[model samples]
Target: MEFRATGADEPANDGRYAWAGTKEGHLFEVDTVELCIVSSRLNVHLSPVVGIYRVGRSMVTLEESGKVLIWGTFDSPDAPQLAGTFKSQRVPDKQNFYAIVGNELWTSSGPVTKPGSSAVSMRSPQIRVYDPTTTGSFSVLPRPMTTPESVGHVGAVTASAIVPSQDHLVYLGHDNGFVSVWDRKTYACLFVQRVSPYMITSLVGVGKNLWAGFRTGLIYVYDVRSEPWTVTKAWKAHKETVLKIVVDPASLWTDETLQVASMGSDMAIHLWDGLLRDDWLDAELNLRQPDFCTFRSIRTLCISWNIDASKPQDLSGTPQNLDFLRDVMLSTESPDIISFGFQEMIDLEDKKLTAKSMLLGKKKGDSKFSDGISSSYRLWHDKLVQAVRLVMPPECPYTVVHVGDMIGLFSCIFVKSSESATLRDVAKITVKTGMGGRHGNKGAILARFVIDDTSLCFINCHLAAGQSHRRQRDHDLVDILEDKSAFSGLGSSSPGAYAPGGDGTTVFDHELCILSGDLNYRIDARRDNVIAASMDGTFETLLPYDQLLKGLATNQTFRLRSFKEPVITFAPTYKYDPGTDSYDSSAKKRIPAWCDRILYRPSDELANSLIPPSGADREDKITPLPQQYRRWEVNVSDHRPISSSFDMQVKSIGAAKRALVWEEIESAWFGVESAMIAEARDYYGGG
Candidate 1:
């Protein structure tokens, strides 16, 4: 039951059967589908088995003691019979000492007896190749009989692979992080490149790409075909040392998408897109295929308000006698996307209401309500829908695509009726930072959906209250973003549709992320000065004192620093007397702070598209522009509502045209070399 597989090799071409060697010198036959041991041969070797490989019909097993055993075909009905036994031609450590390429066996040719000044040691910086088909086993080629002196201390060969796209070339990764490419026939070292200071742990060859993993958990891919071999892409693949890397056999030697995966000491395995072809493909379309993909400049209106449990009737009593909801909806001239976020939809200060909310909350699968506990949510939702329909052009209708409610916090998204048909993969999830995640009094509601190929996320949060709770609020916000199960509901969705930290989606996974709610950050200044600034319409002077802005400037871990917020020209929206334009008149007189705010992080494509080339005209820049960040004087709640309108550029790609562009770009970029690589892979049977 505690079997620790030290090495494994899949001999069956169908991938249904595998043979694993363990540290106890035991060998087991594994049924890969059921992942269980089917047969076992105990104490097959005198020492720990380090590597196993299948060459033609022979099963090759290597041990740490330099013992190699060749077995009869495992597909035979009889128990495994030792076909032959031979000593390894090189010093063996634990693993990665041997590899099977075609019908030849590739292993180290080492312990060459190095005479050193201090001590006599033995280690090989070169590999030996053998063809078992020969009557007497013999080296097929000279194969780097010795490493060149100019290469320096290349160290012992740790990992090696035959380049699939160029079968005549062999790649070797060393303990000193030096990578050397060899000409298989001539045994000449073509080049030696030092990739990292740390040891190279794993190497995978896919076409002209060589993916190398390091002891520092970093992964780098090099274009071996380039003149001065350069890293095409590199990323921190894990938090700990990477152990191994492999390419999916199915994707290799074919036009199918190549998947390169890595295993790390952190006990996590990750799969990556080899060569990042899809990303490059999309980038090509965005940059060169103008006829296939066009930009649509759509307006997005975001509003954040803390209603303090006030009903819609309170707005009717305002002096202007105008519909505040209708005015806010129409302020952006019928925005294509409208998001309204409200905090304190149910008065949390009321003990009875809070108790009822805690006792009778929304059940599973209930998207809208928590029984009758939060009636204000229903009223507010209805009022906002009514306002959208009342103000929009009669021909262009709107649809309430989603509504997420958490007793005291609510969020609703409305899109132009015609654009609603483009919405897909809609999902909403809630995170409770209240009472250590036992209650929903303080937390966030996140809604995410894909429009065509782009994904967007809206987060409405009510952070911890009180002037001294800034750290707590920061912790809560980070928790909401890092929550592992936040979007577990999207498991049934397509693969690679969303990737947060792991396999599920997080707030950061979306292309465009909009954050709004009662963030509870205050303007850090004298209460009197803040009030004076608000009264004199000099709120810009007080912007420097805003805690959120301060965090963006000073805090290294502040995640919102990446988001862009429109300049704050309006007065602070918090601590006002209900039904009046007055600051808090209560005993605890709270300072006037901008608690409710809106911020957004645009997609990299959109941001990059906005930048014009050198000497280009300003009008040529396709940028997402933000405007009209202001507050409404509804005077119905302690916090005035803040709103902003963003003119964002969205991509609408034509499939048939995109395919034509893809073919054009791939042909021009990869040229005839790609075709040659495919033919070479097939001839070598590298897959």
Candidate 2:
């Protein structure tokens, strides 16, 4: 579940404790003194709790079952108790809740319905102004902050935060990327602004503005005083789903930094400082490699401060010795700079890993497409590689790196560095289906490696298409692998391939460690039953590789499409339509499909130590989406990239660790290489 830090300081000689809640309907009192779970009670109902807040000495909790529990102290001497419960009549599913005045609660419910429908349940959230002093019952405020007329078309209120000012209640956030503000006193919507179609996941009030965090890891800050709620700041700071946001007020005053801590489903925590005020400047800064020169990834830069600046200096000139400081300030900013990198693929047969520069392939006239692809890839790759190098350092006991491209091409590049470095390549060696004609022969490099005592393999493969041509693509891929005996004669020796087994066994499978690319075939037409049964592939089919390799898959295979309004404007690679939006009449027609994925197979030791048990998809449960069938609306590519990790120690054995630590490395190898491929199709109007 989720944890929130109370304003209360950590328990010391005093008895103050940090409070935490769970989706399984439990409230936990954690003692900071012992750093242990002091007490936990399952008094609430079984439904997931949306939010918990403090009202004086009492603790308030809102649950998905549409119930609110007001526990904690009602009298001075007595311990906190269940004071009362308030239930909502208009909106039954409590998506979220917040506390204003004591006993008054504001709640929102925008639970995603079934897939393929754009009509979101815009249930106008209610304000229950209660008098806990009396019967402990809440009276629904007659006039909602957002009226039916004003909020009727707006999507559900995904997030809300209390403004810093005590006199006025200003609510600002997204109902599907539409920034809306409401006056808590009159219950009237002041203004509505649509920034992005993606759901607003988190909202934090920073000074006079509110930062709206989106599902795509973008943050937009709106100043309430401005007539139109000016978007003062926006940035792509996180790599995956941004789950939480925390701000430091002290930093605002110091004018040193603006610290924001963002956590995501990628199992990463990122910290961003130095707000880039100009959109063009922010865009430019994001385009360059984050670690180039003195600059570090936003995550590293954020945690560098010792949290305090008055402490005695240390010999290293690091922030570790400074007094703990939470917040910093933002002053001068930098301009937008365009920088690029390369993704290299090493041919084991040739004993070489060549560098491929990350670039965008456009039909020459499109600016948006060019900016989105090149800039987006550069931003993502830079962040990911930097995180890996810093967070999971070589000196750390174990680490694994997983990288993929957004356009449905995937590769699991595994690096095991203890003393030296060894790489592995595992391309598809056999296909399970029939081979048709010349065009039917397709090959995928599942993985590549330098297999010494320490073995590391990189597997890259794109699954079959999702449309009617799926059978052809699927069969062709499998045929190439199946005809391993004839591969030596087909002139399949590209710059990326490893040589045929020099010993002549034709198969390479020992204590093989793995990195894999799986094109999760969401739109394949060949398997009618499979496709119809699960547009997002069945858990069974997706689990085999995970089971066999003893590793975990990183992304939710099936996503509720269009939760966020369209961001990327590329046509689907699998399903092409000449007249449809994703198809450019001037360019070749291409199909639309979501079918790129990544998976990691850990060594047995690593599997037992780090990977969580059960290969089921957990992210899908956290955020559900309504279904919609509009094409080429937002994603750079129809398919999102997937990546997973493994433990280096487990992948290497007793004698191999010392020799594979310092191999020459290229950071953005795979993505850079994919950018050079021929353009698939231009679906957007101009592009």
Give per-model TM-scores: 0.58, 0.37
Query: What 10-residue stretch in candidate 2 is worst by lDDT?
Result: 298-307
**How high is the CA lDDT of each candidate model?**
0.70, 0.36
Candidate number with greatest lDDT: 1
Clashes of each: 0, 69
Could you give candidate 1's per-residue lDDT for residues 323-383 as a string of tens digits?
A: 7777788788768899998888888999888877877776678654565655788888888
lDDT tens readout by residue for model 2, 434-538: 123322112343323333322233334433433445435433432322222121221132211211111111212212222223343443223333333234435
